[model samples]
Target: MNEPISWVVAYPEIFLLVMSAVISLVDVGVKSRLRDTTYVLSLLTLAVVAYLLGASAASGETLRSFNNMVVSDPMGQWLKCFAALAMFATLVYGRRYAGDRDMLARGGEMFSLALYALLGMFVMISGHNFLVIYLGLELLTLSSYALVALRRDDPQAIEAAMKYFVLGALASGFLLYGMSMVYGATGSLDLAEVLKAIAGGEATLKGSAQVLVLGLVFVVAGLAFKLGVVPFHMWVPDVYHGAPTAITLMIGGAPKLAAFAIVIRLLVEGLLPLAVDWQQMLAVLSVVSLLVGNLAAIAQTNLKRMLAFSTISQMGFMLLGLLAGVVAGDSGNMANAYSSSMFYVITYVLTTLGTFGVILLLSRNGFESENITDLAGLNQRSPLYAGVMAICMFSLAGVPPLVGFYAKLSVLQALLASSHPLYIGLAVFAVMMSLVGAFYYLRLVKVMYFDAPTQTADIVAGADARSVLSLNGALVLVLGIVPGGLMTLCAQAIAALLA
Candidate 1:
């Protein structure tokens, strides 16, 4: 008989699976009045997985288990750590909002779905093949769709879920079709082998190159839909605005890191040899996303919708580094570019979490936190909360002495150093768009400090909300002040992947 495999190798996924199962069982069998149990368990699961990730990193052992379907590598380790951290922050800011609105009754389902989604994200980060990527993507997507419709009673939530489900299905279909084409062309699902085949000119089938390129286009489109990139981002505003605040926080925060990981694996790992083709494609997408995402967001009065569009614009900025990686092949610039992209992802998660935390603090039941006017008297009511919100808005706008500024600076620097004039032009445009984005962010600040209260006199700030919001808000400033450490870690993780 074969010896049992060590469970430690698959610890990340295993932890989530165990927690999810236990939560599900408890929900079924146990009659608990405290609906927060599942949410607490979900948070604990993230903490445990985060510890495991740290231990794995400390051990410094790169292990491929289960016939190499999953591997523990530096890149995967770092991403898992980031994902866990983001999830934890999301849960912290979300639980109270859910509880207050009576959204906690079925909160266990949401938490379990989040865990499943996280398991998929973990698989995605460690994936070495197309099959694994697809499995992870599907798991993540399916769970997310359910989470969007958590409040089934609400018409808007149901509508958003419907839109999301239909659009997500179409994207998945395209992605699967593309994966099939790539498999046909390369005769292997393994990303390493596919890369080798492409490098060796072994991908020669009837229209193999075209098929592969078409497949890549479809894959990018599908992933872009997840990233909320412009033209593919129609679902974002509606979904963010309609979904519960807790769900919005989860969707906006952790999943973006997972999407970034998937992009790195698929584009950088799987299609590296086709750099010239995909680089230009990403460049165009990046430009369009930046221009359209920023311009459209400026017109949005709904806070969540604005942030949704802002997320799209941010994805465009993140793509700059990815494009640079491909465009600067063999010059070692790709490594730097990849690092910059990772750095940007981390910074963006922090800023987004803090921004949403503020929203949660201000919002009460029956009142959706969806307007800039809602923040008018925030400074007068709670100066600390207002200050934190200011920092988050500034960071999102790419202001100096903040983490977001460095993220933008690094990506633009990478783009400027690349040989492509078009990339340089787009980078400049993105910078200009950042300035354009700043106007709205600053407008919020003006409302917070200068404008008098317009919405309501009774500003409710719960204790749990204030604590999380304060920490989340301060983190933006703290990270901005001492970004070198995280930046170094991101650089190292990217370097390991490239190595």
Candidate 2:
């Protein structure tokens, strides 16, 4: 089996790599006063990638390459498109912040790093072999570490980077150990082969099932850390709060799409035989994350910290989809549940991007825009800002007619349809916890719209920030009003994966 020479299949990753190189060269060689060049380049790169992804989707051919180490199907294509869109939004949101802070001198580096991270994402989405998956994971993890330390002068940034690096290394170790154990047990590196082996008497190997289960536990633990699930999520709050707000926005948004894809590949494709074991583990983790994330967020005064906890809770909801997809007997429901999970991830990216956009807009030099108090009397000071923030708050609260509401509803629907009584119980608990989550989001709305302005401070929002914020904020409403298009596409992607 030789690798396929499918130019169209490789176009998206090729474009990203080329654009990243060109942008880096331009940054190093060109001495221009206009800081917007990097921003423009990033936007152009994103547009090109999105166009290529769309073309690939329209072609409707699943392309596998590198001797089947990589697989490009509808699901991968759609997720890559979403990732590109999210990256574009992050660039737009970060533009003003980067420029105003004179960070554009390094903007090319940021864009390059982001593209590299995106490369990892693409690899993760398309990977069919454990080697490919681990390679992609390392690329993403390393690039992210560099990105967190982009602001070298800030001690807080350095501290956050160090923390992220250390924890990420541990997670990688766990993932590697699991991979080794799986290889030892099954004598295969390809996901499909691993599954076939397990199904065809490989389970009879001496203690193979136990070893495989333990290996999977480690693998999930590592991935769960990336997802910010409970017990493995301690780094989230500190990193979110300490890193630059723009970086925080990036972390909170697009990465989830890639993470979700990786989970599906590893758990659904590679470890399907052990679904019963992992499903139970995920159920417990999901329940804990939901309870702890919501309850802990209530005590948080720092805006970023609160959002960090919120991210953890959101992961729990995502896990519900995974749980539903891993039922003991009914594989049909599992497929539908995976589709639901896909929908949930899409909704999450939109809602989180919009939420962080508001934070970026209000943030200024010397002020992180991180405290709930920063939003005080925002309605009195700037009704537009107040209204945008309120919409984000409502969406995050899972209020009706908004994107977040649909996301939560979809996941819960998947959970409810599961045959497991405990899964249903957990779903019910998630709904109640969501109600509690609403209180804090509402509190922010109250501060923004009802409270009095403590002091009139000059808010300096640059053009890039303003443009991205307006677009991001409007997206929440637009998606809420007419979600059918994206939802239909998501359904299609999910259907393809199961097919």
Candidate 3:
């Protein structure tokens, strides 16, 4: 018998879908230069969706609908709410930046596309089935490709879009192929069923565990690509540098939370029986990502590229938390481990918004603020923005009195709690790489505070952007000082899932 559709559980996604379509359709009637109407409508839609997500979470029960293809839970709701907030902030920060650059020329494509991408993220986070997850991923990737190519006149943007499309398609193929193998081995597309089959040792395939393990390798590689880890991270710097700053913020900020969700869904939720196997793989990837990301970042003169490498290293730290969850037959700390990663990702995204927001703030028409030298004497131009950017940089470097520091601390604590020699070694290595990474971040601070101004123009931004950026930076510091509330929320969400 088919399960009754629980419309209330998916109300936010439904609302977003309707609003996205309406905005797209309405955009046609609106003229090209007046895209602010679309932007305003999109932001309103996100506000409503966030409210709906909050309401859903307050219901306090995990709700599954459509034959368990979708789930509404505290974790998904919290992640979705934050992602929507991130997108909302991104739009506010990008509006003038995009307008000044004429990227908003095509009526409402950019605004509508962002809404669609947010919709895709909502679907990805809530999906409980393999096909549903893939569908959501495709939607998000396709929207992102269009967004990157928004400035069709710019060859760099077009090239970045092409590369993103090709690489995204390849990753999608790997993920789909791996899912097929998993389905072939487990005889199910539902995550819960796959977990049941694997844990019960009833997943009968031609080669049994070997086939599942092979599928896992492909799956992890696909995920690594999305997360922009080393060896699979060739596209990150190019894309971030090539894409407009607005689009870069769109790509870098919220999709990461969705990626974390899918990893938890596919690996932690479904294939936990093979944790022993994937743990080794993730451990290796983590160490390599940390080493390569931090080392390579030191050589980058471009701020975007440096931040991209920094993102790669940050992801490696998040993976450490994920790896700490399953330790040689002791799943007792699983909730805490995953919760730590959750906290880390949430805080990382918050910091990324402010970091990129500063970049966007410094940018004006026909002038892209991409180079490290571009920030020279920024303190002389605007002490406030320089402070904001400095806070973000320090936070990313995991400095004290900042949220990023606490995020790293929580992840390391999770790893050390595992009481495993290998994890301990990884912890030591990660700390050392962090120190190396600090050089670049501190270098930016020096350039901003110490170097002479290359351009003497005033850093102009809207009140909304300035206010939001200030709040974003302030949150990084406030959360670091008092991280207990958010961390406890994450812990409760994860613990509820385990329960």
Candidate that would win on TM-score: 3
| Root-mean-square deviation (CA) per prediction | 2.2, 1.7, 1.1
Better of 1 and 3 by TM-score: 3
User: What would the TM-score be for candidate 2 when compared with the true structure?
Assistant: 0.96
Report, for every candidate in turn, its global Cα lDDT versus the true structure.
0.82, 0.83, 0.91
Question: How well is each residue in 1-499 modelled by candidate 1, as lDDT tens digits?
Answer: 4345566678778877888899877766434443556756777788888988977865556777665566687778878888888888777777666766666564467667888888888888888888888898899889989988888788988898888899888888978888888888888888888898888888864448877888788888877887888788888888898888788888889888888998988888888988887787777778888888888888988888888888988998998898877654555688888899999988898888888888876777687766988888788887887898899999989898988898898899888878678778877788899998888789889989999987665656656557767877777888888989888888877777777
Q: Tell me how far the alpha carbon of residue 134 in candidate 2 is from the true structure, in angstroms, after superposition.
A: 1.4
Q: Write the per-residue lDDT of candidate 3 for residues 1-499, one digit (tens) a residue.
A: 9888879878888889999999999888777474866877998998888887877766667989999999888999999999999999999999989988888775668888999899899999999999999999989999999999999899999999999999999999999999998998998999999999998888753457777888999999999999999889989999999999999999999999999999999998899989998888888888899999999999999999999999999999899999989888889889989999999999999999999999998998889999999999999999988998999999999999899998999999998999999898889989999999999999999999999989798778888889999899899989999999999989988887777
Ranking by lDDT: 3, 2, 1
lDDT for 250 in candidate 1 is 83
Worst ten in a row by lDDT for model 3:
203-212
* Candidate 3 Cα errors over 4 Å, as ranges: 32-34, 204-207
Better of 1 and 2 by TM-score: 2
Output the better candidate (1/2) by lDDT.
2
Which lDDT tens digits does candidate 2 get at residues 1-499? 4765666567788889888888888777645543557668878999889888977875666877777788888888988988999989888777666555555564467778888898898888889999998898899889888888878888998999999999989989998899888888899999888888887867556568778888988998988988989999989998898888888877778889999998888888888888888888888889999999999999999999999999999888889888887566777787668877888888888878877877777776566678999889889877777777888889889998887888788788888887678878888898899999999999999988788887488776766667777777788888887877777777787677666
